[model samples]
Target: MSGKGDCYDNAVMESFFGTLKNEWVHHQQYQSRYQARSDIFKYIEGFYNTVRLHSSLGYMSPNEFEAKYHDNP
Candidate 1:
């Protein structure tokens, strides 16, 4: 990851967090750490993995790609 053209090692994570904040975090004000964690978990599991389309995965959600992989492999 330290080689040439590998400078974007954190690019994927940065992009994910950027999307998280843009689509989820910025719209809400949390009253507690537990509440925020719970809601974020719900968003990630119930919505992000199940429904959000990822361009890097050919526009499939994580669950869809995983299912396809299991079906073929």
Candidate 2:
């Protein structure tokens, strides 16, 4: 939904990928596309979304942030 040639459109994703590369990708050497895909999945689901504390989310992991505000059944 970004306008043509907009500078800020990719900022969020650029930040995400930068974090992914810095925290997870740079240390590993994968042998195949499947291996890379699987490891990234584990990193995102197992650690980033569940355990990583994001400052933008008030130093809470995304799961914690969502649970804090949306605890209604």
TM-score of 2: 0.81
Pairs of colliding residues, candidate 2: none
lDDT of 2 by residue, 1-72 (tens): 889778688998989999999999999999999999999999999999898999999999989888988987
Model 2 lDDT, full chain set: 0.94
Show where candidate 2 strays beyond 4 Å.
1-7, 71-73
Alpha-carbon RMSD, each predicted model: 3.4, 2.5
Off by over 4 Å in 1: 1-9
Model 2: worst 10 consecutive residues (lDDT sum): 64-73
Model number with the top lDDT:
2
lDDT of 1 by residue, 26-59 (tens): 9999999999999999998999878899998999
* Pairs of colliding residues, candidate 1: none
